[model samples]
Target chain A: MKFFRNLTIGQYVHKDSPIHKLDPRIKILTSLLMMILIFLTESWWSFLIIGFFFTVNIWLSKVQIKYVLRGLKPILVLIILTLFIHLFTTPGEVIFQIGVIRMTWEGLSRGMFIAVRLFLLILTTSWLTLTTSPIALTDGIERLLSFFKIIGFPAHEIAMMMTIALRFIPTLMEETEKIIKAQMSRGADFESGNILKRMKNMIPIIIPLFINAFHRADELAIAMEARCYRGGEGRTHYRALSFKYLDKVFFMIISFTIALIIIINVV
Target chain B: MFIYLENASYTYNLNMPFETKALDSINLSIDRGEFIGIIGHTGCGKTTLLQLLNGLLEPTIGHVFIDGVDIHQNKKGLKEIRKKIGLTFQYPENQLFEESIYKEIAFGPRNLGITDDLLDERVKKAMKMVELDYNQYKDRSPFELSGGEMRRVAIASVLAIDPEIIILDEPTASLDPQSHASFLTLIKNLYQKYHKTMILVSHNMDVIAELAQRVLVMEKGKIIMDSTPRNIFQESVEQLEKIGLELPQVTYVMHRLKQMGKEVNSGVLTIEEAKEEIFSILKVKKSNNEIF
Candidate 1:
């Protein structure tokens, strides 16, 4: 079995849609604003509006709907359990009683609302990752954090670390698979047994994984040094960020939608 | 028989968006005391096939029988099958983790429940087989060793299990010529001395020609040819070329010489064999010209 879950984190689905082509910085800022609005507003009707906005964004991103749904698979059980607990345990105007359990209409509504909020949050974030490439995301973060350079925040260093970490995710995953196979061949059984036995079995696999990661880190540092990489100083990018008219238009539409959601909630 | 794959087919990320059929309907039986070589281009399912032999991966479609028992059927005792078959991965030295070289080699035997005297003996024997001195390297950290030494320690770790079948995937990859030759010699000696069944996966024609009696050629996810190395290199050269596998340098030279009307044998694989054949041919020609 593969160690790394196929969760599709930081994965970009290459597409030539308008949403995909918009500057990543614009998309990043807009999504952040939308997420904050989602958490700020408490009204249910406003959430429906937010949900509609996300659905449109998902459509514009042109990523496969099936893939986006697959990314939501892991949270399904958690959401269901959460809803069940909230519905049965909350003591309000008890509409039904079943052997020391009380159920209320208010609890049911609140549980449904919480579940919807979670679903919308996950879907929107997944849409962001699907449309934006990792490199572009790092670039956006670095540019936005450049404002903190005045306060000695080491923004460039942080961005470089993030980019490298993202880059090595796949490599380390492949290495982990290899090490697991190696240990397995040596009679290291990781799947069977109780929790303690299984955890004890992971010792061999984890030790080797850590060792290989350190080895790779050392080699990567040497290679980077040999190539004269010095903390992103005096560096020029191959692809420069240029804001297009569409980026401005997309930003305006997102801001307007957030404003409308807020106004609707307040009224 | 040591290991067998019966109509085994494996697909990566099965039933997912990224699903890929890595192996397709592969049926092969590896007998004890036999050396088999597997050669293929990149992404030709060579590594996937190797993982199947050791039960690191279960076949999606069929059974993997190690010593005539289906391994997947008994999930709890599958560890025993793993102990019986040792698989050394490509660039396996990267997985070195033990603080000392001795402990690293002892890892496998210890996993098999060998204790004290037998454990020490197994470790020493494995180190000796890989030509690493016990006293000189037993306590040293594996990370501090040279690249070639680290590779040997990795192989020794597998050897400590004393498996009936040893599968090495590209054991000599990324080594200097001298180290490569020495590694090949060590593998050859292991085969001769222990008579353990070996499944060697490599793209190096010279190593395969010297070690394997039988060779399986893979292209994509299918086994294209399975025959003796001599027959494969002699008869299937064109097909192998089409699949992007180059012949050994000596074999290429031998083929060129035959094409140029020289009476050199096409099956000459090693440089020494080619040298002897060319010298004998020249000697015979010189005597005939002197008679004329």
Candidate 2:
């Protein structure tokens, strides 16, 4: 129960490091490019190169390596499960056999590639999220999507939704823990019950949490309307995103590295 | 001692970078049928102490005993202890999920294996204790009630279990003045008529002065002062003020009289006591005037 308070996922870490100071639009764009490069990566050389890039980016962001790795914990089981499945199922040169469970050479290589790819994908996105605040992220996303407005994209509404969701994650978690404790005080056994019983016990907690969430949503809407919040039409931002000299330098560096990686892959 | 904590301490997120010591070696003994008030600032471990008492959280260091038995020693025993100690959280109405108030208040007792006619009786008794008419409000959805009625229903849910001890955390925090006064009266009646050991946690000094037999003052995760309400208000006014705790309003009035060169006792707690002290001084002045 105490762990609920510590259930912090990869949220923004406020710091004045170089990465945090860069334009969030550039960060989002580079992160997108990095995802592409990660998918195209099939060799250890490319992975090694990209891994080095992530190390440098994380260092520049002033975030500890351990904190970034902690985000990988929830997915570690999935990664390992995939690796084991690949080890047993992929048909190739047999490394060994344990009662018809054929361990293949290609399977080993493929599993390693997939594992490293997923790991780097998580690392890159977490890097972007950790360095940029939600407000900045929402602003950057809206600006980027505003380019697609000719396709009838509701850029403002989508950005507002993302911002609200990100804002309430922590608040919701606190409320959840409080509801659980309140129920527990009334002798509701959340711990020792079987699956069905445990789930049934959760009704006491979930119902109240939902009621409170809906109440909060209603109040927030009223509050926003009271403040005369119209749609994103003709609305300006408090933080007007600007591309600066430093942004140009980082942009060029990232573009050059990604270009070099693409050329190597093609050749 | 019916309920006792022996050097209980709680540290959240142990071995993590953001670990916090919420309670620091609290040793306290509370007898049965005792009405105790715990006062502290918002993050001063009062709620944590309440949770520890009812076995919602296990103490990281010490032990909590209910009737000479360690509640945490066995799962079966802990549930029984929970039956003996009912806890109502602040805005407890949020936990109400049943379609009707009857099912809502019956939730606790039903969980304890009371059912059929026994369950019906318990629900009716609990509703009556909160001053809600059983037949009128039992079938209504808890969500449809006003804020104060919903709270009374919430408190009734705890009372359904018939726990000898009831722990409330800021039970009257956001109530209207009328509801607040009535709520206090209800609590006083619950304690006096039913002999329930009431452990109330509130920052409202006047409420504590009126209701609590003893006061426990907390600061920085420690129990710094434990005394009768009048003694705590009279003797520790300066110390409490230094720690940013507000004493009862009437204590200040009495203290003001003492500071104005009047021979006034400076430790009155409630409005009634303050009025009596003032009238005594005025009556003596009139008698002296008649003699002259």
Candidate 3:
């Protein structure tokens, strides 16, 4: 009961490895390139190539295979459901039939291809998150988006918001747990009710969570002001990012992979 | 008897890869008017244990009985049990959602189906219990109040239901000393005035020492010690230290004095008692000096 609901987003596991040491900008670009290539490839063989590269990269990251798999577990049901729907419901020549249910070879292959693509996409994105700290990620994003500032885009503000939101994920999770325990002690029955009743019971928990979240936001704003935070205008980073030789090599490999996938699809 | 957990144990995310045993097999009973202090380090199952007592969590291996009936046995009875045992979580101010403090306090009683005059009376009484002035604060939005005031309003919201037992989990966490002291006094008044059974889960030894008649110490999902506060602090100082808990300041001072060859009892828990003991020792030393 205490463990199932502790799912937190953007939690980076600290480790000393090649992937962890890579420049955040390179990782971000690699992730984006992989996502683009994944969408570009329509053939099965290219997926195999991409999957092979993904497996090797994950292995090199030195993260426990189990932790990456754990992140995948939450999305497994969605992937399976999507595959089943795509395989059986798409109109095509019947490869197999069971009463009203019919399966087509094309649909089956497409389903498998889509599932694998989605799986790799999620896994690669998770790898980026697992390896890079949130601060570094946002810093890279802010720097990348700074180009848009010339066109009147509020890139710095957006980046600041993202960083703060990411920073509060764990704090808010801990607070939510405390609030739930408090309401539970008050005899709020959240577990054993019909859908409506359960939702009704959640009023106690959700209300408190929102209240606390806002309270925290207010306090954070004041604290920031007290510390002379003037919204990313004159801010200097504690750790300025520098791209190394490994970053260059990593980006070059990603570019090569994308080119190969695109060339295969075109041919 | 109001609540009873018979040989209960709870594990979080059972059968999952991240499974953890939050509470071990334990037996506990709370009468209608008893105040129980549950003390433990972080992750020691104090919060889990509180959830069990109020039937927010059904025991994985045992049953929770409220008013001589198992709460999980029937839906109607479970609702009643929830109404009977009101829990105020630590930093409860987060739960305030209504537009006004009055409505926030009235929320619980309304859920329990009380109406009209009785609801108003309960709201007013609950506000008074927490030392909130109904006239000044009731019409105000809870969101506008300071952290301490919002916390009191949150507690008032729960008290409106007139629960027989109240459970507070680290009620004074992160508050200034003045606010903490005032909040403690408010809770003490609730115990004395209404005689409601209270279970306070806290890591603050001073709060527990001042409030709890009986203390339950938990470590690694097990109740390591359950006794009167005096007994637990005096008899198991070494064990408590091993579990990352410290005795109250007065008790620590008394223990140090005893170690330094002074004729002083180490069981004293409050500053007032320590003052009397130190004064007597000083007088004795002065008399010896004159005789010399």
TM-score of each: 0.90, 0.93, 0.77
Candidate ranking (TM-score, best to worst): 2, 1, 3
RMSD of each: 2.8, 2.3, 5.0
> Candidate 1: which stretches are off by over 4 Å?
A1-7, A76-92, A97-101, A265-267, B259-261, B285-292
**Lowest lDDT 10-mer window, candidate 2 chain B?**
B73-82
Q: Which ten-residue region of model 3 chain B has the weakest summed lDDT?
A: B88-97
What are the clash counts of all predictions, listed in order? 0, 0, 4
lDDT of 2 by residue, A1-267 (tens): 454766675478989899999999999999998899899776677788888988998998898777788888889998998888898899989999989889999899888888989999999989998999888989999999999888999999999999998889889888888888777767687778789988888899889989999999999999999999998999988889999999999989988888878877877
Q: Write the per-residue lDDT of candidate 3 for residues B252-277, one digit (tens) a residue.
A: 99999999999998998878889999
**Number of the top-ranking candidate, with DockQ as the measure:** 2
How far residue B173's Cα lies from its native spot in candidate 1, in Å, is: 1.2
How would the candidate models be sorted by lDDT, starting from the highest?
Answer: 2, 1, 3
lDDT of 1: 0.87
Clashing pairs in 3: A185-B87, A186-B87, A208-B94, A208-B95
Single out the weakest 10-residue window by summed lDDT for candidate 2 chain A.
A1-10
Q: After best superposition, candidate 2 residue A251: deviation in angstroms?
A: 1.5
Calculate DockQ per candidate and list them: 0.58, 0.68, 0.34
Off by over 4 Å in 2: A1-3, A41-45, B258-264, B285-292
Best by lDDT: 2
Best candidate per TM-score, number?
2
